[model samples]
Target: MSTQPEHGADKRRSTSAMAPRNLARLCLTYALAGLAGYLATLIGMPLPWMLGPFFFLTAASVLGYISPIVPMGRELGQVAIGLAVGMRFTPAVLLATATLVPHMLVSTLYVIAYTFVAALLIKPLARIDSVSAFFATAAGGVADMASVSKEYGGDPGSVAIVHAMRVALVVAVVPFLVFFLGDHGTAPASTEVGATNYLSLIIALGLAYLVAVALKPTPLPNPWLVGPILTGMVLGVSEILVVQVPSFLIIVAQIMLGTWLGSQFKRSLLVRLPRVTISAMVAASFMIVCAGMGAFVLSYFGQMPYATSFLALAPAAVTEMVLTAKVMNLDAEIVTAFHVMRIAVVSSTVLLVFKLYMRMKGSEIGPGIQ
Candidate 1:
């Protein structure tokens, strides 16, 4: 009888000791996952390697949701992704408007309208909330929309699903669209650009890291609209000023963003996979239809060719869209602009509506947490 009490005491002591160790292990796992994800993207992974972070972090998050291993929320993720997007800006990107401002504006407005249309159409089919539908249907990348959904109190799971479907569908479909539509005489990327100067690459990576760290402290007023893209753009313009920003560094950041986005796919996240899959398909198809409409308007205003503009409207990552534009020798500037505009419009609209709703409800609004 005395031995039984002694054994129970030992068990309690061991459990207490194990808790902190397990937490340390979890943190290490997530850090490694982030690094691995970046490596995978560098080696030509179809998706971003940073996804490794999302995957493991998601697992930790789910565990925390049930018991508290790591907190699961989208705020930090949103800010990171947003800051990366802000880095995409430069004066040249704005210059796309010189001859095509009216057209670009029309195309942008069309895409915004189409997001609502997609929400309306897909709602009946997917059996998800209209806000969820709106997010999924937006003509922005799946990752961006998912982040916005979390910020606006929409269903993150559903947003993740729909956004994934849009990206997968577009990536699958757009290559063929390019093959069929691209001008037959178009040249592939120059061999000089591909030769890979190692010294340049190292310098670029260092700069990317520095810039990413610096931007972390900048008060990003609605980073989802301005962070990553603006940062990229500013740095890009610096290169034109003879500051010599390496191209490889920007690519590294892009890869990081992509990988991080993928990291959301943890085992625990799988629980809701079935519902997410269904919603994604319905939302993607509906959004595609809306993109078609946007393309028509862009064609009318910009007098830009229909194929490239349509591809711009296709729901995918800005990086992919811009890369495709460069490959097909289409106007990459327009593609980037449309992408940035879409995120800005969608995030702004969602936040505005959320604020109004909260105000009307007269409930407490929690400021976003880091």
Candidate 2:
């Protein structure tokens, strides 16, 4: 009996010692990862402002072989921004949607075709699975790609890595293109905050939140945010109110999104990532090709400028793309249209494809393991 008590005491002591050691090791690891991510950002990586942290979390989950469903904080920032824009849709915008729907569909086909080509190219070069390649080439935002990747059986680690690289490159590269390739002469003077109407903004937000909550049961991404904004915009155009999207709010949203996203890098993972850079480049080229085609098609339909179409087609965040349009003095309406359309198209297609794939495989692709 005495010997049994001694054994129990030793076991408890062992657990007590292991707990702090494990916690300390994990903290050190995360700190190193955060440091690496910050350094990568400093050296001119395009790290999508929100997608980066999500990627970091995803990678951590994958490495630990933990459940890959990590909560994304940056997504909240994106939802807020998306909701704000959704609120900007006036009655005129809604009316135009009738015409835009067909156009969006046509453009969607081209986007899908382009995405397929991206997947085909990535398969041979990336050594990643087909589903991962599909999401990687989806021509949507980095976070969107990650979400879709999870929907299918795609590797979360690869999706995170590919998305982080794409955002970094696009952010670093696109600004230069805007400065040089954009119509500097026609760029509008910056929006004046003093001229912004606060009552209208509040009304838009309130209406949007209400609509969003109503749409919560659906699988639409961030329905509470996107749905309400869309409804608010409709109301705005219907003489319910005149809403103004202020520049300061947009900037604050972007910075908050960007800094939080940028913090997901770990030096060790990055060092391992160099091996995957070629695959990422190939994937990026595939995305650019899709964007180029989208630019041409959207231009043909909306008669929107190429820069506006190109930004929309590029798989960057909607808020970031809109902000880019603002900075370049491009058309925000066109930017929003293409971005929203891309999300609708990709979400619907990916979900349908995943369903069919799971049915065929006799198992849930991205669902919890049996």
Candidate 3:
């Protein structure tokens, strides 16, 4: 009986000691992420706050320089990003892009086909199971695809790594390609903020947070992102509020997202999965080429700018592409619409495709190529 009190005291002491250490680690992680973002900005990197921290954190994680705990503030960061995306959806912008729905549908189909082909190639080169390769090659959001991969008997970690690499490659490469290929002098329009704007921004954020929480239990792909986006779109379309997400908040979101993504990489993974990593990079490149070709086709037939078409066709994360479009002064509404359609279609059909593949293969469930 006397031992019980000592045990309780020891547990309490350990907990008290751990709490401050955890807090310090978290603060250190954010500071490093923020520094990386600042450095990227100084060098004129595209989406510096995001890409910078992503690269930095990935390297830091692999080098064993940072703790692996995901920052607690990451979800709030996502909410901020959702709000930013939502503000772009004015009724005029929606109406203007509505005519492109057919085109988006066709483009989405092409993206699916391209993803399958890439998966087939990676299966042979990487010796990954079919389900894993399929999910890894999918052109959906990384977290969404990773989560779905787990449900479909795919290796979620492998899928996540491949998806992260794909998005990183697209984010790093597409902007430079667009800039060199198209006019770069035009600047994106800026919004002026007043006191009323701040109030509206707060309301918009609150609505987004509430909606995201409500949608958490749904079967939606990326409910956090989708919920807030839908809420923001409604607000925008209804003209209930005209608000701008502050630049600082945007940077914070980017840092959080980047850090989260970076923490997904493990040092052991690099050593153990070199073939998977290299093959994923190759597959991603093939997909990018396919997207570029499709973009060229769209440009030729639709008489649209090649840069805009490239952005719409690129299989990068929708948020990343939309942000890039905004920065490059491209038609962000059109780009966002195309990506949303592509993701929706891909998310809905990916499971069906896996089932079909399983049926065709007679349930052996072996490594696809080896």
Candidate 4:
């Protein structure tokens, strides 16, 4: 009894001692991310704050220069970005986007079709389970798909890596295409940070937070982002006097998101499944090509800009695509709406389809494929 009591005390003391160190490490990580953002901004890189920290931290994490932590800030960053994007949805913008609904629906279907084809390709080539391939190619958030992968007896790590690669490829490739190939060569109109009202900002954020909390238990994908965007849209469309979010806050949001994304990559994870890695890269490339083709068709038929259509159809996360649209001065509202529909359709239907496939296939491959 005496020995057990002493050990408990020692454990408590160790836990207490580790808390401050962990906090300090987290602070240091944010500091480094901010510094990286600053350097990228100086060089005039596109979406400098975001891309900078993303590339820097990804390099650091892969090289063992930084230890990864749970990305607590990413949720807050998402809310911030969502709020900003929502503010762009004035009545005029909403009306303009209404006509694109049919196009959006068609593009979303294209996404689902391509994802299924990609999963089929991945299943045979990568030799992963059908469920894992389905989740990996579903084009939802990496974290979301990875969580669901466990339920279907899929490889969570493989799903995560494939989704990560898909996002990284889209983020890397789309920006260059927009800047070089698209007609827009200049940045969007800047938000006047000086016009910000602190009280309104606080109220908007508070409402966003409450909505996020309420939506937390729901099955909607990325509720944190969706809730805030909905709240902000109501405020914006109603002509309510919410202040513009300060530029620095937006930058901070970008930094947090980029840092979080970067930290997800671990060398060990990649090293374990070399074939999976290569297959994922190939699948990501194919998805991009599909998105490009779909975008081209939509743009030609809908008389929309190619860049806008591409961002709308690209199978990346909603937040990432929205951020890219903001940087490129495309129609962020349209992009957000399209991605929201895509995520909803994919998240709601993929599991059912997987289950049906299992039922039809019999016991040949119930769980993990190989």
Which candidate number has the best TM-score?
Answer: 4
Which structure among the candidates has the greatest lDDT? 4
User: Mind giving the per-residue lDDT tens digits that candidate 3 earns over 34-69?
Assistant: 899899989977778888888898888788664433
Count of backbone clashes for each model? 36, 7, 0, 0
Q: How much does each candidate deviate from the true structure in C-alpha RMSD? A: 10.9, 10.5, 7.3, 6.6
- Model 2 sits at a Cα RMSD from the real structure of 10.5
Alpha-carbon runs more than 4 Å astray in model 3: 1-18, 68-72, 141-157, 179-196, 355-370
Task: Tell me the lDDT of model 4 at 355.
Answer: 63
TM-score of each: 0.57, 0.65, 0.83, 0.86
Write the residue-wise lDDT of candidate 1 on 1-370 in tens digits.
0101122333443354358756665456545655765665575443333333434444554464221113211223333333333334456546654566555565666666665566666666777765566666666545455666666556766766666556655654564565575432243233224455466534443444455456555543333323434544555567531122233433444333433333333444445556666666666776676676677777666666776677667765555555555435566556666666655565556555444434554545435422
> Which scores better on lDDT, 1 or 2?
2
The residue-by-residue lDDT of candidate 4 on 166-249, one tens digit each, is 887777677667767655624334363357888899889888878887998988778888888888889888877555877788
Q: Which regions of candidate 2 fall more than 4 Å away from where they truly are?
A: 1-80, 83-88, 140-154, 184-203, 206-217, 222-225, 351-370
Candidate 3: C-alpha lDDT? 0.73
Q: For candidate 2, give the lDDT.
A: 0.57
Model 4 clashes, total count: 0
lDDT scores in order:
0.52, 0.57, 0.73, 0.76
